[model samples]
Target: MFMRKSKFRHVFGQGLKRDQCYDNIRITKSSWDSRYCDVNPKYVAVITEAAGGGSFLVLPLSKVGRVERDCPLVAGHKAAVLDIAWCPHNDDVIASASEDCTIKIWQIPEGGLTKPLTEPVVDLVAHQRRVSCVKWHPTAHNVLLSAGSDNKIYIWNVGTGEVFTEIDLPDLPLSASFNFNGSKFACTCKDKKLRVYNSRSGECLQEGPGHAGAKPAQVAYLKDGLIFSTGFSRMSERQYALWDEKDLSKAKEMNELDNSNGVIFPLYDADVNMVYLCGKGDSQIRYFEVTDEEPYVHYLNTYQSKESGRGVGFMPKRGLNVNNCEIARIYKLHNSGLCEVIPFTVPRKSELFQDDLYPDTPSDTPALSAEEWFGGKDADPIMVSLKGGFVPTRKDALKVVRRSNVLDKMPTRTSQAQSTNSEAAAAPSLPPKPSTTSTPPDEHVGFDPQGILDDMRKLKLIVKAHERRIKTLEEKLSQYEVNTSEEDEGKA
Candidate 1:
């Protein structure tokens, strides 16, 4: 028998025990094709069903147990929440888009939600139709892109509450993604075409035929100017393909995965060059190794389970268990109101850190600001070492500084033939002002001194907790070294 000699060939999936999972959650019943859940190192947020408006539950990763019926929620939108994404540079920050034709940015507290969060840090109301998707820039601070049913995409600077760029599409976008450095953008549209564009300039770069099916399609930008997409064929058979950005007239490699009707969600790990495909309402996760060779995508193995998942949230690499050789962790949401934690680990007997399985992954640091990115600048993500285990740095609360209303001061248009050039020139020069229009008189204005003091107190407590955990880990590592030395001496 011949076997592949790869470090991840023996990878296995393990589901946590029932007590370790979150139960009694009222997941949303929206028909929207979204993950419905998002996770980070600090918290895991799940879109839940609400009566009057849209709401989602944000729980600390340590609070794994049966949730109460009246748990606190982040409720604000007037409609169902379609998508949610956590900021890559700040674990405490998250963005949510909804059918209310707006997007909201929230900042979760350190100890988790004690009361219902009705107010968002920033309220963006630009889309005329319901917003479908929201994504944060990979390496930029406070930069966000949102897609709406109006056949439009707007890139916003959350810190400033301003639209940095507006891109109009011919059809609705099924999915959108940014390249590794956040310089290029790609999306699959309802017109059955995959379109690539300059993210900043909103210029269409290329367009080609996407999947042949009528169902929704997804696109993910990979390393080295590559793109991966998943959709159905004309016969409704599930299929996947890899494409080169330079030439999208045809896919570099294409293959049919299966005949399942569930939508396949692709999650890519750039460090290991592996992509995991998880189908909605399916009990299996198929993974593949991507390369630059002839067959670009090579199928590995599949992780099968008895229970199917309605949505899945992937944990960042920095949150994995390095001591246990764990490479990936996914939080799968079930129809039975249960959220299960599944860990994928590579088989290894050694107790030491495995550098090959874990490379220098992206850190929680912004490589560019919103102004710089909108000014046509691009930079790679900042990488951090995980040798001694990753310790998250404390970050201050995000501040939103909006410009004054220039529309109120502009002269009224006398005729329809008035040049629009004057209006565009006046927008940028408006003096900056604290956005207190949305807040009540009693509420704290832009930089709240009391809020800062509270945040500092919470950060101090968090630092103390991390220090204690690190000390315990150090002691265990020392004991393991001593035991290994004794065993070696006895063998000699």
Candidate 2:
């Protein structure tokens, strides 16, 4: 017998709000770095330059949409802003990397910026070439890092403007991410190699061959100290490889996927140990779960759409729904607009609490000084609590996924059809009893190809008719409900 499935099942939910996609938000098409905030999910920052040099515009997100009237615009970078990273420790502060070869830190007031924030809190001017990516320290607060074309990565204190470590390399770095404990970082370089460096000592911990193509690669750390990288092969096929961060002697698993024209960017969810692979020109985000076993990468499902994305942004775990077991939320950027994709757990309605949804998510804690981080101690990230949580539920929180669609839920239709065909073809010779009772005309008893098609078409038409009637009734009911609610309010 098949083993029982887990109580919590993860799947995509309806996009939260209407009028979701925002158009003409200034975003750099070339840079792969995230231009939105992951720490504070309430606001999102983007580079918007309709008339001239791009300025940083912060939009306060509401359940309905972004509040455009009170949006704040910070103008400081002389050139187009390539990347923006919000400080995980402080929600009011953010940093921007620009093509001016300088990184600027801007502070957003609590009530939202009334006027343009033309001045920056601090500026670090050291990179020789254009800056590409800026990432805040995961565990250590106030510490930020920036990589530029000057073939150097600089880690500095965002508040003091002090350089803690400058990693000089021979090649330009593409992407960089701190490990789980912030002891080390794995970065991708222009030479098609992944190099993991010690955070405090700036020593190379490991190096190995990645996707082996000319295009830039992206890397991220996994739950079991394994690091995964995505890049293209010599044949121009997109692929990803997983390796142990400590031992780069061999890759744990290397898998090639559908050959596409865009580079695959991996978005990891530490809460669920699932990695979502999204490509530049693709309309679907493919995800897989990594386990501690052979064939570690288990194929999940794909979320598809009609339009493709120029860029995608992932929200932090703390912002996700702890009650519903939300794995991740992706913001897909199209040429005209932006769309949010949310993945939620499909738990049984009878379940009391989903234990899997609430992992120790990467969260912010008290800021640590530079001395504390360099002291060679493990710093743990704060996690959102699961047991005795804030959100209250009345037994059944989320709706149940009912298997009401007969055709959609049926799994043995094909096998049954094949068996019927085989039996009809290889049947024993019929006895003379078939001639009894005036020998009724031999009707076509086997599966008729046209008959099945006709039946399916009829069923589809009937479903559509029923759907139309239901929609009409729902609209009328909604109108009546609104009227009744207004009357009740008046009575009250």
The most accurate candidate by TM-score is 1
Top-scoring candidate (lDDT) = 1
Give the Cα lDDT of each candidate: 0.82, 0.66
Poorly placed runs, candidate 1 (over 4 Å): 1-4, 396-492
Candidate 2: residue 433 lDDT (0-100): 24
Model 1: lDDT of residue 246? 83
Residues 1-492 of candidate 2: C-alpha lDDT, one tens digit per residue: 843243323465445443664544545555544433233555666565534565766766543353363455888778877788887655566888888888877767655578889766556666768888898877775678899988989887553454678788769898898887677899999888788998777888888777678877888887668898888889878888888887776788888887787877788877778788888878888887787877777776788877787776677766666556565677776655454544545544544556656655554453354445756666767565555443312212112211221111112342233233332121211112233577675576774553453344335434543575588699999999999999999999
Give the true-structure RMSD of model 1. 20.8
Query: RMSDs, each prediction?
Result: 20.8, 29.6
Q: Model 2 — which ten-residue stretch has the worst lDDT?
A: 401-410
lDDT of 1 by residue, 319-393 (tens): 889999999988888999999888999989999999999999998877776656777889999898788899875
TM-scores of the candidates are 0.81, 0.73
Output candidate 2 Cα RMSD: 29.6
**lDDT computed for candidate 1:** 0.82
What is candidate 1's CA lDDT for residue 438?
70
